[model samples]
Target chain A: MSVSVAQTALLDKEPQFRHAIPTRDGRTARNRARYTFTVLAFLLPSAIPLLLFVLGPMVAAAWVSLHKWNLLAPMQWVGLGNYAKLLTDPITGDVFVHTIYYIAGYLPLVYFGGLALALALNTALKGRSILRGIYFLPVVTSWIVVALVWRWLLSPTSGIVNTVLAAVGIHGPGWWTDPHWAMPAIIVASSWKDLGFVMVILLAGLQAIPTELYDASKVDGAGWWRRLFSVTLPLLSPSTFFVIVISLINGFQVFDQVYAMTGGGPNGASEVVVQQIYDLTFRYGRAGEASALSWMLFAVVLAVTVIQVRGQRRWVTYG
Target chain B: MAEALLTARTPARRTVGRAPRSREAKLRLAGVIVLHLVIIVGAIAMFFPFLWTIITSITPGASLTTTPALIPKNPSLGAYQRLFVERPFGQVILNSFLLAVITTAVQLVTSSTAAYAFSRLPFRGQNVVFGVYLATMMIPLQVLIVPLFVELKAFGLLDTYLGALLPTFATAFGIFLLRQAINQVPRELDEAATIDGAGHFRIFTGIILPNIRPAIATLVVFAFMGSWNSFLWPLVVLRSPELQTLPIALAGLQGQYTSQWDVIMAGSVVSVLPMLALYVFAQKYVIQGVASSGIK
Candidate 1:
């Protein structure tokens, strides 16, 4: 798990107080039983649902991935058959590539844009709080609403973006309607929505950097650019790494925006992995194959996350 | 002030340092202005789509092809009326509201109890069980939706609100967040209560819950927003129009009325306003929560 610095700090703190129970006489055994029962009672509310819904479903997914079954049909044992089929399926590869394309475009744009916002707002500027609120509005808005608004904003003929571009004597690309542009359109909305989230995280990181470091650098004749490079970014690397890992994980599951905007249409140029899983099960009645592909995605996500966690030690400076 | 004092002390270097210091102040002022300009521009770009949505929703007879006027000549509330009168939007919104409230309430109870267990109660293999819960956080709901759907059907919960709400009753993120909050409460308070013959239940309610109110508020806002905005499970489970939540309803509206920008944007406004309102009121908690957790 690529735990963020903030989360790890919380988790690593030692328990502050421990119960001191006397081990005299036969009361100790009764007290232990009573303590166990009380603990179980406290945990029961969440434990039942977690077991039935989350953990059980995970095990079931793996089991179903090994069998062939539809919603209304008897299960046919097909051990590893779905995996083999999906491995050869070209759509699976295409969806993975398209998902990668989304991450490739989205990660850099959102990260840098958010970094700029964080840096700008980290100053003691007036109305910075209001500005933060404005930037974060889209983050709270649902993806469906965002996609619809962007679909209108990026409408090929009379949308605001194209209208503005045409005023500048540049013809705008057919954004959601064009095959080559669909993913980019989705990427734009996705990045716009997430910039504030990244900004919030990075801004916290920037605020955590000690002012003494900047003062020390200033005394050393470090200019603005030098201070930014030498002082700000290296210290901001943990939050940066946290943001990237999260964005990459989320980018692979990009579905709602694509589902609303293009429906993976215009020659299926924008079909991503999660949407593929959705379509395979819901639209095509291929539950087993969908489960297989989901497992593949799980593997990819796990591998990527683990690699990032391991790789963070190389670049992520703690302080 | 320090620079001024230093330059004043050395007469020979006074003129040399004073000139650059003035220029440096001017440069700093210019930098601040530039920074504000860039940030303002970015803020406008971020807010423009929302502004456009509101504008298009009000402009009568608006369609996607019509270039939206920043200030409508004669705005009308007919689109909102159409949303309620022509569509079952009233019922849909109510459904979403009810679901969000119920989900938030249930999650708060479940998560707080579980957090109380993890933080205060020592048990065998406690770390291992907690680790398992944390590990589940990394698994996306997409991986479980298929089996979850099948399980719901077996339980005869498909196409019901329970189906949509069941899997969400317990969240690892909520438990983790609340656990952190509970750990911050002074243990002496718990010990004092225990010494006074207070049991775990009373201590949880009287001491822990009251102290962790901020975390509860944060979780409430997030849980409400999450349930309100959740799409995949609701879409898969709730098939009836009468039971549609906001996101599912809006998606259906988009699919059904592909070109009706006014009605669709009106729906967008209705859906977004509650969240923005909640955010406006609790912006600090929301931002701090996201900053700490990096999840939303």
Candidate 2:
């Protein structure tokens, strides 16, 4: 009986083992096919819209940049003509300079102010959440709302800011209307709206820092300022880098607030690249010029992003 | 934990080293006080504008002389009434809501499916595809507006809701965020389900989706807010008044009623309410979304 049982077990095991290899291989091939299909199926939904709207438009914009075609007119081929015009155009140059000036004035306040807020809120103090919420309110609010409210607030005649300044024996400039103050006004409103975002990001970076580091620094006899400069800032570099890059990108694309508040007014003091693009395309009936300007803006943004990516290694430290 | 440690060490050090310890404690207390004071001032400055907006909106005949009041002397809902009666403001609100909701829903579907593929599925050139997706985030919508407009026109979708909605239907940021969320989910659960003969779809729907609810919630708030607040594209598309979203309609109102600050403020207040309510309710998810995603 034992010998018969052993013989049957051996007979069963031999055929089963021999059949298992090819079936396993077949299963793997089938699984691979299944995975490939699933991946494609999952990707197509996003890929279709993204390709149609984003990637395809990028190429199309490039094509449009090379040709002149108003909505009603026949297409005219103008290879590099628009690009040459963008370089020579005084408006484009002024817009580019203004964009830079705005960035220069805006980014520092956002970064430092944001870091200060984050540092304050990072403490285990009461009502920190409320403070955070207050700071963050403007971030969720629409840019148009912010612009409108600010426009009302900064009105030269009746606005609260000038009124308060008058009470304090200080004269406030005509913010949105004055060429000197228009960009500054936009910058102030933008800083206010964007402050919360930077603060929240920095707060997250701050919280991610382990308690052990602070304790260790304390034990090492580092004062608050020293500890902050050495440990906190170094560790928070990545978030700072992120904020700088994002702010620069958004700064380059400043449109909504400029549109709502100034309409690039006071002789185009606050005219940005996007506002210029809008005028060229719709108002002036120069789609080709607009497309070229758009490409230029894209190139500037891309260059800045690349520079930031490369420059981050100098300052950004990871633990 | 650090706070406790600092307090604990202070008490211990105080017993042995009284003079310096006391000075340090006093300094620390002063620092805390100063910190709180600065934060309070900043908070007030941050909140004062909104407060002013609210006061201005409610105050009847809110003009130059009666401006900057903390409390409205004679508050009225006349401007709000004027907003709806004078213009198709209610319809604009509906349009904004419909667009935001539809955009959010579609973005959820597209982003989640693509995120699942990027995070879980192994396929050829996955890295390259994902890199391309991420690259899209750097390309601002302003760059594509002209061509996108042309493309929509080509498809005869110009001045339509579909045109406004199509460009926003898929976002690289959403996909990146959701993919990061999915990556946090444990792979063992997926493996276990697969061992039970479950397919990728089942695992994605059952395990992955369930685990990433917070991320989804975060994305919802973001996408909703984005769509609700979107100005440029909606401004460019949707030429007709009937199809106009709230922001565009508000811009129109501003143009039409340039000096009617009361009505304009009222429009601003009304447009901000829904989003403010959303933020108040989903504050946690929104903050966490921004924090975890590490995007502004």
Best by lDDT: 1
What tens-digit string does per-residue lDDT give for candidate 2 at A1-319? Answer: 2333222322331111122122453477776566567778999999999998898988787888898878578779999999998898788899989888889999998888888777766665567667877888788776766786788789998887999999999999999989999999998998998888777666655644544556666667776676677678876765676578667777887888888789998898888888888788778888788888887887788778777766765766533
Model 1: residues with Cα > 4 Å off, grouped in runs:
A1-45, A151-180, A200-242, A309-319, B1-25, B86-88, B108-131, B134-143, B153-160, B175-219, B236-243, B255-259, B284-296
Candidate 1 residue pairs in clash (backbone atoms < 3 Å) = none
lDDT of 1 at B37: 76
Q: List the residue pairs that clash in candidate 2.
A: none
Error of 2 at B23 (Å): 6.1
Q: What TM-score does each prediction get for chain A alone?
A: 0.82, 0.83
Worst ten in a row by lDDT for model 2 chain B: B2-11
| DockQ for all models | 0.30, 0.34
What docking grade does candidate 1 earn?
acceptable
lDDT of 1: 0.77
